[model samples]
Target: MLEAIDIHADALKRAALTAGPAARVPNCPKWTVHDLVAHIALVHCFAIGLAMNRPAKPAPPPDWEDLLGWWDGQRLALREALGQDPGSPAYSPYPGFDVTVGDWTRRMAHETAIHRLDAESALEEAPETRFSPEFANDGIDEFLTYLAPRLGRKTDIRVTTPERTWSLGEALAEVDGPADDVYRALWGRPHRASVTGDLAPVEAP
Candidate 1:
């Protein structure tokens, strides 16, 4: 699993580097490849830090002078932490669960796989990523089982794109689209493959 994580992270970095200078992430809309890379690194560190109960790290202001340094530090921190002790126990916010470092590593790898596609779209390159059916299927499962319900009920965000009714098994922010579209919509990213359903934003919880 640790090896898998390293491979995915390396792939992501390579993908980011390949992004043309003019590339703009459609999902992130306002961010360039550099910003996306930084965001990914920051998220990587944030998750690991929380799991390890590290002290809260500062989030640099967007476009701040120190942003690059901050991102580099976090990226290295995450890499070192994951490598040092992949078997350490960690707590997750999910009820009735204790996720180990191995679990987090795998999770990050799977996440990087999907996001790589979005990054690729911004780069005008083929994000045609490949992963085992086992990993992709597990990601779909985890999203349904653990992540979805956290969004709570919002009767307004109905699915109209698929022209059929469906409910999120969890993460109840409903929308109409292919399963893949649903995946992005869950993350609040827009994809042309989807048409907006009857969604109305309410106050954040």
Candidate 2:
């Protein structure tokens, strides 16, 4: 999981640098690359704080000049915090889940991955990054099983991929494609999956 986090985080940094701070992110339409970078850095810091059982001080986003460096530091801090005893008690961002470093590690990995796609979208070049089938399946399961409920999403969608199939809600709709496509679709990211029903309800929060 830590390796996944590192891979996505580094990829996100590369994409952000290529896009430039002023470039608009296609996936997160309202955000420029600068905004996207700041957001991820802040989130990383927040997760780090949680892992350490220390509340991070609320502060303005890093200046554009320092953004990447600041984010890199936070990412390292998060990795260190999460690399501690996996069973260590920690506050959970999601309710009704284990309050442990393991959960935080999983959350940060997905968070980095989803935003990594956003960074890629900010670039004019075609995004070459890809998620493996197994990784995508785990991401899909994490969203459907944990995030959807928290967001109050009632979408009943059945997702099928070459790797596996999962039922979200009551499975009123079916989306078919590769696991990565299905995973991105659930997160409202660009995907090539085929959908047989309304996808509005299944949209990520």
State which candidate has the highest lDDT. 2
- Candidate 2 structure quality by residue, lDDT tens digits, 1-205: 9999999999998998898999999999999999998898888999888988786864435688777777777878888999998889987656676577877788889999999999999888856778999899999888877667766787588888997887756777888898889889888898899988788787786
What digit string (tens of lDDT, one per residue) describes model 1 on residues 1-205? 5566566667766666677434788766787877777667667767667557563555644653355556567656766667656678865655666666766676676566666766776766566554554554454444444444444424334343333344442423445445455544544545433544433341122
Predicted structure 1, TM vs. truth: 0.62
In candidate 1, which residue pairs get closer than 3 Å at backbone N, Cα or C atoms, i.e. clash?
148-170, 148-171, 149-170, 149-171
Clashes of each: 4, 0
**Where is the poorest 10-residue window by lDDT in model 1?**
196-205
Model 2, stretches more than 4 Å misplaced?
Answer: none
Q: For each candidate, what is the lDDT? A: 0.57, 0.85
